[model samples]
Target chain A: MEAIILQILNGLDKGSAYALIALGLTLIFGTLGVVNFAHGALFMIGAFCAVTLQRLLNLSHEVIDDTKKDFLGNPLKVDVPYLADWFGADAAQTIIQWSVPLAILFSIPIMILVGISMERGLIKHFYKRPHADQILVTFGLAIVLQEIIKAFFGANPIPTPAPPAFTGSFDFGALIGMENIIYPYWRMVYFAFAMVVIAGVFAFLQFTTFGMVVRAGMADRETVGMLGINIDRRFTIMFAIAACVAGLAGVMYTPINSPNYHMGMDFLVISFVVVVVGGMGSLPGAVLAGFVLGILEAFASMNEVIDIVPGINQIIIYLVAIIVLLTRPRGLMGRKGVMEE
Target chain B: MLGLATKDFVLLLVVAVLCLFAPVLLNPFPETSDLAQFNAGYPDLMQRFVIFGIFAIGFNILFGLTGYLSFGHAAFLGVGSYSVVWMFKLLNYNIVPGLLLSLVVSGLFALAIGYVSLRRSGIYFSILTLAFAQMSFALAYSVLTPITNGETGLQVYGNDPQYLQGDSAPNIPHLFGMTMRATETVEFGPWLWQFNAGYYFCAVVMLIAFYLAIRIFRSPFGMMLRAVKSNQQRMRYTGLNPRPYTLAAFVISGMYAGLAGGLMASMDPLAGAERMQWTASGEVVLMTILGGTGTLIGPVLGAGLIKYLENILSKINDNILHQWFAFMPDGLEDFLVAIVHPFIGKGWHLTLGLVFMAVVIFLPGGLVEGGQRIGRLFGRKKPAEAEAKAAAKTPAE
Candidate 1:
C-alpha cells in the first residue's frame, strides 16, 4: 500500500507537467484550429527565461576586501553580485536563491509576446492551408527555435534550484501515519503550482465573457464570426493564455528537471501523446489523461512491473498510445468530427 | 525506351549519364588544392548521396503522391538494417540474400503499421507513426537487444553460422567476390578521381529505384494515389476503395527505405538503433521537401545537397573562416569569423533549420520549382509563352 502511494507521488510531478503542456496544446487547437507543433519550443523558452534571470542576478564585478587575507598575505578578492550591491547582501542572496519562482513573473510577459507574435506572424497565414502544411511549417519553426536556443545556451543541461526554503524533503510519511512516505517539498510545491495554474485557466475559460466567446468560437467559429464578435482577436488572446500556461509549466519544471536546449523536444513527444490520449481540443480530458498516463508510466517503471514485462517501462506509454489510437480513434473524450477528416 | 514516355525516357537517360559520370563530375577540384575540402566525390559520401536519394525518392512516392506524411519511416529503415545484419550473421558476407530479406521484412512491417495508421489522417497519423517509431527505438535498445545487440549496435560476430561461406569468399560485405570498399583512383596532371565499386553498385540500384518510381508515378495506380491525396472522400464516393492503394504505397515506400538500409549495411556492416530515431526520419522528410515532393529528380538533388552541406559546412571551423577572411584587417577578420562560426562546425543544425523554414515558407514546391522560377526569370526572350509551356509540362496536381 505504501509502495503504491509512493509510486503515485512519484507520478504526480511528471503528470502535472504533461497535463499543463497538454492543456495548452488543447486550448490552442480548440481556439485557433492550428496545431502548434512549436508549443514545445515555447515551453523551452520559458525554462530559459529562468536561466536568463539567474544569469542577470548573478552579474558581478570584482571586489578587494582589506580585512580578508589570501595565502600571499595580500587583501583577498571577492566577486560581489550587482544585486548584492543594490539590495543588501542578505536580500540579494535570498533573491538569487528564489530566482526560479521569481521567474514566473518575468516569463509571463515574455511568453505572451512570443505567443502573440507566433500566432500573428506565422500561423495566421496557415489558417486556410492543409493540416500537413501547418504541421510541416510548425515543425520547421520548432527546429529553428531549438537551434537558436542551442546556439545561445550550448547543449548542456543547466541545474536550476528551488528556493532555499523548499529545498529539502518533508516528512509526508509521519504526517499520514505511514513510514517511508517522505517526499521533496519542491515536488509538492510544483504539483500545487500546476493545480493552481490549471484551475486558473479553467476558471477563466468557464466564468468570463471572453471565455464564453472563445468557447462559442471553438464550437462554431463561423456563427460567432457572423455575430460581429472579433473572434480572431479573442482567439489570439486565447493563444497567448495557452502559451502562458505552457510557460509557467516550464518555469516550475526547471527545479525538477534542469533546463536544457532539447528539454522541449524531449517533453514534446510525450505531451503530444498526452493530448491525443486526452482527445484533441478537450481540456478536462487533457488533465485527466495526463495524470492517468503519468501514473501508468510510474507504475510501469516499478521493479515488480519490470520483472514481469522485462522492458515495459521503456515502452509502456507508446504501447498504451498505440492501443488507444487503434481501439478508440476519437480518444477518451474527443468531440465529434474534431480532427475526424 | 523502356516503355517510358519520351520526356520520362529523356529524364531517365539524363540520370543514367549523370550516374555514370558522377565520380568525374563531382570531383571538380585538383587533389592538392585548398578547395579539395569541398569535393564530395569520395566513395563514402557518394554512396550516402545515392543511398539517401533512394530513401527520399521512396518517401516521395508516398508523401508526394498520397500526401501521407509519415514520421516513422526510419523505423523501417532500421528494421531493414537489422534483417540484413542477421542475414550476414547466418549466411556468408553476400549482400544479395540480406538485401532481398530486408525488402521482404520491411515491406511486411510497413504493411502492418500502414494498415493501422492509415485509419487516421493528418496530425493523428503522424503522431501514431512517431509513437510506433519511438517504441521501436526503445525496444531496439531494450527487449530487442538479443537481435539488435542493444547499444553497441548489431554487427557480424565470428561465432555466427555463416553457412554459405566458401574459401574464396571475401571477409567483408561483398557481391560474390567484389569487395564493397574497393576504390580505384586515377591521377592525371594534379587531379585524382576515384571509381568506387560500392558507389557504382548503389548508383545502379538507385537508377532502378528511380525507374520504378517513375513508372509508378505514370501508372493508373499513381493517378489513383493523386486522387486520394486531392480528395479521398470523393474517390470513396466514386465506389473505389482507397485503403488498398494507400497501403500498397506505404509498403512500397517502406521497401524503399528498407533497401536503403540494406545498402547502408552493405557499405558498412553495422546497424544501430539511432537509425530509427525521429531525427533520422525527419532528415528524410527534410530531403523530400527541400528537393521537391512530387518531382522525380527532386529528392535525389535534395539528398545530395543536404549531405554536401552537412559534410562541407560542418568541416569549416573558425580557423578556416579566419583564413578565408584574412585579406581583411584583424578586427574585421575576427568579426567575420565570429559571425560565420555559429552557422558552421557544431552549429550546422541552426543553418539547416533556417534554410528549412525558408524553404517551407517560400518554396513550397521545393528546389525544382525554384529552379523553374529562376529559369523563367532569366529567360526574358518571350517569357510568357515559355512560362505557359513550362507550366503545361509540370504535373496536373
Candidate 2:
C-alpha cells in the first residue's frame, strides 16, 4: 500500500506538467479552433525563462578582495555578481538560489507577449486553412522556436536547481506508521502549484464574464459573432493565457527535469496523447487524463510489472492511447462534431 | 514512351537525365576551389539524397494523393532497415534479398498499422500512427534487444551466424560481387567527379520508383485516390468503399519507405532505434510538403534540396563565414559573420524551419508550384491551358 502511494506521489509532478500543457492545448483548441503544435515550444520557452533569470542574477564582475590573498600574491580576484552590489551579498545569494521560482513572474509577461504575437502574426492566417495546414505551419513554428532556443542556449541540458529550503524529502511513512514513504518537498510543492493554477484557470473561466463569453464562443463562434461579441479577440487573449499556462508549467518543471532544448518535444507526444485521451476540447477531461496517465505510467515502470510485461513502461501510454482511440473515437469526454471533418 | 503522356514523359526524361549526370552536375566547383565544401557529389550524401527521394515520393503517394497525413511513416523505414540488416546477418552480403525482404516486411507492417489507423480520420489517424510508431521504437530500443541489438543497434558481428558466407564473398553489402561502395573518380581540368556504384544503383531504383509514381498519378486508381482525398463522404455516397483504396496506398507508401530503409542499410550496415523516431517521420513530411505535396517531381526536388542544404549549410561554421566576408572591413566582416551565424552550421534547422513556414504560408503549392509561377511569368501561355493542349495531343505521343 505504501509502495503504491509512493508511486502515485512520484507520478504527480510529471502528471502536473502534462495536465498544465494539455490544459493550454485544450484551451487553444476549444476557443480558437486551432491545433497549436508550437504549444510545446511555449513550455520550452518558459523553462528557458527560468534559465534566463538565473543567468541574469548571476551576471558578475571581477573584484579584487584585498582581505583574501592568493598564495602567490597581492590580492585574490573574486567574481562578484551585480546583484550582490545592488542588493547586499546575502540578498543576492538568496535571489540567485530562488531564481527558478522568480522566473514564474518573469516568464508570464514574456509568454503572454509570445502567445499574442504568435496568434496575431501567424496563426490568425491559418484559422480558415485546413487542419493539416494549421498542423504543418505550427509544426514549422515549433521547429523554428526550438532551433532558436538551441542556438541561444546551446544543446546541453541546463540544470536549474530548486531553492536550498526544498532540497530535502518530506517523510510521510512515519506519519502513517509505515516505512519509506518519503517524498521530495519540491515535488509536493509542484503538485500544489499545479492544483492552484488549475483551480485559478477554472475559477477565472467560471466566475468571470470574459470566461463565460469565451466558453460561449467555443460553443458557437457564429452565434457569438451574431451577438456582436468580438470572439476572435477574446480567443487571441485565451491563446496568450494558454501559452502563459504552458510557460509556467515549464518554469516549474526545470527543477524536476533539466531544461533541454528538446524537452518540449519529448513531452509533446505524451501531452498530445494526454489531450486525446482526455478528449479534444475538454478542459476537465484533459486534466483528468493527464493525472491518470501519469500515475499509470509510474505503475507500469515498476520492476514487478516490467517482469511480467517486459518494457511495458516505455509504451504503456501509447498502448492506452491506441486502445482508447479505437474504442472511444471522441476520446474520454469529447463533444460532438468537434473534429469529425 | 512507357505509356506516359508526352508532358509527363518529358518530365520523367528530365528527372532521369538529372539523376544520371548528378555526379558531374553537382561537382560544378573545382576540387582546388574554396567552394569544394559545397560539393555533394560524394557517394554517402548522394545515396541519402536518392534514398530520401524515394521516401518522399512514397509519402507523396499517400499524403499528396489521399490527403492522409501519416505521422508514423518512419516506423516502416526503420522496419525496412532492420529486415535488410537481419538479412545481412543471416544471409549473404548481397543487397538483392535484403531490399526485397524490406519491401515485403514494411508492406505487411504498413498494412497492419493502416488497418487499425485508417479507422479514424484527420487528427485521430495521425495520433494513432504516432502512437504505434513510438511503441515500435520503444520495443526496438528495449524488449526486442535480441532481434534489434538494442541501443548498440543491429550490426554484423564476428560471432553472428552467416549461413551463406563463402570464401569468395566480400564482407560488405554488395549486389552479387560488386560492392556498393565502389567508386571511380575522373579529373577533367581542375574539377573532379565521382561515379559511385551504390549511388548509381540507388539512383536507378529512385528513377524506377519515380516512373512508377508518375504512372500511379495518371492512372484511374490514382484519380479514385484523389477523389477520396477531395471528398471521402462523397465517394461513400457513390457506394464506393474508400478503405481498401486508402489501405492500399498506405501499404504501397510503406513499402516505398521500407525500400528506402533497406537501401540505407545496404549503403551502411547499421540500423538503430532513432530511425523510427517521430522526428525521422517528420522529415519525410517536411520534404514532401516543402517540395509540393501533390506534384510529381516535388518530393524529389524537396529531398535533394534539403539533403544538399543539410550537407552544405552544416559545414559553414563561423570561420567559413569569416573567410567569405574577409574582403570587407574588419568590423563589417565580423558583423556579417555574426548576422549569418545563426542560420548556418548547427543552426541550419532554423533556416529550414523558417523556409518551411514561408513555403506553407505564401506558396502552399511548394517549390514545383513556385517554379510554375516563375515559368508563367516568362511564358506566352499558362501551363493549365498548355496542359489541356498536351492532353489533346497525348494519343500521338
- Candidate 2 lDDT over A1-341, as tens digits, reads 98799999988889999999999999999998898889899999999999999999999999999999989978999999999999999999999999999999999999999999999999999989988899999999999999999999999999999999999999979888899999999999999999999999999999999999999999999999999999899999999999999999999999998999999988888999999999999999999999999999999988999999999999999999999999998889888888865
Pairs of residues clashing in candidate 1 = none
DockQ of 1: 0.77
Model 1: runs farther than 4 Å from truth? B380-397
Q: What DockQ does candidate 2 have relative to the true complex?
A: 0.86
Worst 10 residues of 1 chain B by lDDT: B383-392
lDDT tens digits, residues B188-300, model 2?
99999899999999999999999999899899989898988999999999999999999999999999999999999999999999999999999999999888888877888
**Model 1 residue A64 CA deviation in Å:** 1.1
The residue-by-residue lDDT of candidate 1 on A1-341, one tens digit each, is 88899999999999999999999999999888888888899899999999999999999999998999999899999999999899989999999999999999999999999999999999998898888778788888888889888889989999999998999998888988999988999999989999999999999989999889889999999999999999999999999999999999999999999999988888888999999988998999899889999999999999998988988988888888888888888788888889886
lDDT of each: 0.90, 0.92
